[model samples]
Target: MTISRWKPNVTVAAVIEQNGKFLLIEEHTAQGLRLNTPAGHLDPGESPIEGCVRETLEETAHAFTPTALIGIYMARSSHRTGNKEDVTYMRFAFAGELGAREAGRALDEGIVRTVWMTADEIRASVSRHRSPLLLQCIEDYLAGKRYPLDLIHVDESVR
Candidate 1:
């Protein structure tokens, strides 16, 4: 008998909407070019909120201050380059203020560009989305779904 430990890949995403548009990244993925919100895997020694801020900056070259959590979601995907194992992702989605892009800062590697799209445009282009959660998060934001930032408590030990 073998004991197994299962852990989902925890990640954070920033749902940055401003002036009737939502900020998204057009990046190259295993599935080819795809659009996604500013999102990435949470790093060690950082809380989910901090991870969101970092990911938003890295992907969009902009500062973000998360105000509310949109939701937490889990999904299984099989997109590894050469692996057949399905990976489960646990994502914490946040909505907040997106600052101006940093001058002379380069977008993260694999990110082609940053673009703003209206909800209608996003809905129409679901086929190009990197993940199903991308549109879900945006729609949730538009639907006024927001949870207090304190909803998830990160112990000091985790930070």
Candidate 2:
């Protein structure tokens, strides 16, 4: 018998804040209404922080300046994309400031709108979150979890 090794997919999330409210994207999913931070898969050639910044801008049409990393989260589940299978995700979350909103960039497909909500409001809407990490990241940020931007270092040759 052979045991197959499991590989968890990596994702990066951004938590942008303004005046004590968080920026969340409302997106339509097969499961109905869902809310999530500006986040997505870590594309090739981008570090977690860079990916977070990119995802935020893509999903929110706003510039994001990641000040600190929150924490990492891991989740596992089963779903059928066309066939039933187990899936896992490792998420890197960051808390930071949002720069000015761009004029012409469109929000990513499936994104309904962006909203600002307090942490308490987020906690109340837990059932509508796309993933548990949504609230976890917010809570962690509120708990004062912050890491220096210099923590992520990539060589210039990698660019």
Candidate 3:
């Protein structure tokens, strides 16, 4: 019997807060319309921080500068159908500043719109969230948990 190595899919997310609300993306998914933070998979040759910044821009049409690492999260999903396999995602979530939106830029594919919601509002819409991490990241941010950006080390070789 041959053993297969398990590798979790690595992703990055931006936990952007303005006023008393957090930024979230509304997109179409197999499970239907769902809300998530500005997030996506890490791309080749990009640091996690860079990936988070890029994803935030692509999904929300706003520039993001990550200042602090909110938290790292891991979750498993068996609901994905096409691949017929269980998958785990390792997410690096960052707290950041959101800059001006690019004029007339369309959001990423499948993204219907961007919305801001208060923590209490988010808590009330748990059933509409794409993943539980969306809320976990926000709660962590609310609790004042943050790590310096220096905590992540990207090797020069990756560039």
Candidate 4:
């Protein structure tokens, strides 16, 4: 008998805040237009921190330097009410600084535009978020929760 291996999709996100507002992107999703942090899957041969930087640039057209790890989160996303097609995502959340946008850089394909929203605005629009973890990360950031980036290490094999 053969047993299939189950693995969660690993992703990285940037939690960038400035002047009491958080950076976010409005993007097209299968469910419709949705909001999310600058985030994406961890690509082959890249660490979570590197993936976070790359995703931020792709989504927001800005350079991001992650300084600390916020928290790791896992969420099960379902297309509908059924559990059969649910996908579990393990996200490595990081707090970072966003540099000025690159001139004339196109946003990621599905990204409509960038928006800075307050915590209350984000809380009120939970229905429009790509995943529930978005708010959790934001709230955690607001609460001053953080860890050193050294908590995660990438081996030379993946470098």
What C-alpha lDDT do the candidate models reach, one value each?
A: 0.93, 0.89, 0.95, 0.95
Error of 1 at 133 (Å): 0.3
**Order of models, best lDDT first:** 4, 3, 1, 2
2 or 4, greater by lDDT: 4
Q: Please report the candidate that would top lDDT against the real structure.
A: 4
lDDT of 4 by residue, 56-104 (tens): 9999999999999999999998786334477999999999899988999
Flag the better candidate by TM-score, 1 or 3: 3
Separate clash counts for every candidate:
0, 0, 0, 0
Q: What lDDT tens digits, residue by residue, belong to model 1 across residues 1-159?
A: 999999999999999888899999999988899999999999999999999999999999999999999999988888668777688999999999998789999999999999999999999999999888998899899999999999999888985
lDDT of 2 by residue, 58-120 (tens): 999999988888988998867665678677989999988889999999999999999999998
Clashes of 3: 0
Compared with the true structure, what per-residue lDDT tens digits does model 3 show for residues 3-110? 999999999999999999999999999889999999999999999999999999999999999999999999997785576768899999999899999999899999
RMSD of 4: 1.8
Q: What is the lDDT of residue 86 in candidate 2?
A: 78
TM-scores vs. true structure, each candidate? 0.95, 0.89, 0.96, 0.95
Candidate 2 or 1, higher TM-score: 1
Model 4 lDDT, residue 59, Cα: 98
Model 3 / residue 86 / CA error / Å: 1.2
